[model samples]
Target: MSIRSVITTADEQVPFAAVKERIVQAMCAAGLGAVLLFGAGFSSMETLHNAAHDSRHSAGFPCH
Candidate 1:
């Protein structure tokens, strides 16, 4: 018995609609999360502020 690999036969076009749907979903989720965090709905004031502050420092963003 021989094993074979299935490769694209050049008949398939890029699935643009599917790609766009996934991209839009991801962006929406990120936007919702950002609103929750920045709007102080995700946690208390101190926790949110400290988390943002620490992340900024770690990422080398000016937070001073």
Candidate 2:
């Protein structure tokens, strides 16, 4: 198959609306993750704090 045909076929597999929806979903997921991160920081529960602390260290966030 020619390069143009290959490109066109790949492009048709995902519609613009589908791409936009995926972007929106990704943004919403990220927002929720940020909220959870903030909530974990303020949580009074020791388990939550310890889990978040360990995860931060694993992710190289430099939390003491």
Candidate 3:
């Protein structure tokens, strides 16, 4: 491929690459949120429960 064509192709792919990156980031964030919300929120360990509770309280999430 010519240099100009290669540059054009790369430019065309920029938007697609950015969109894919955003989707992956969003999915990872959601997965992490689920783990923290359910896994830590309902843990049998007192330390985990207290940590989550304190974090929620600090964030003003109203756990009560």
lDDT of each: 0.83, 0.86, 0.84
**Candidate 3: deviation at residue 36, Å?**
0.4
Residue 11 CA error for candidate 2 (Å)? 5.2
TM value for model 1: 0.43
With candidate 2 superimposed using the best TM-score fit, by how many Å does residue 31's alpha carbon deviate from the native?
Answer: 0.4
Model 3 C-alpha lDDT per residue in residues 1-64, reported as the tens digit of each score: 7888656654355678888999999999999999988986677798887887999999999998
lDDT of 1: 0.83
**Tens digit of lDDT per residue, candidate 2, span 1-64?**
7898656654467789989999999999999999988987778799787887999999989886
Q: Once superposed on the true structure, which residue ranges of model 1 sit more than 4 Å away at CA?
A: 1-14, 41-64
Candidate 2: how many backbone clashes?
0
Give the local distance difference test score of model 2: 0.86
Choose the strongest candidate by lDDT: 2
| CA shift of 18, model 3, Å | 0.5
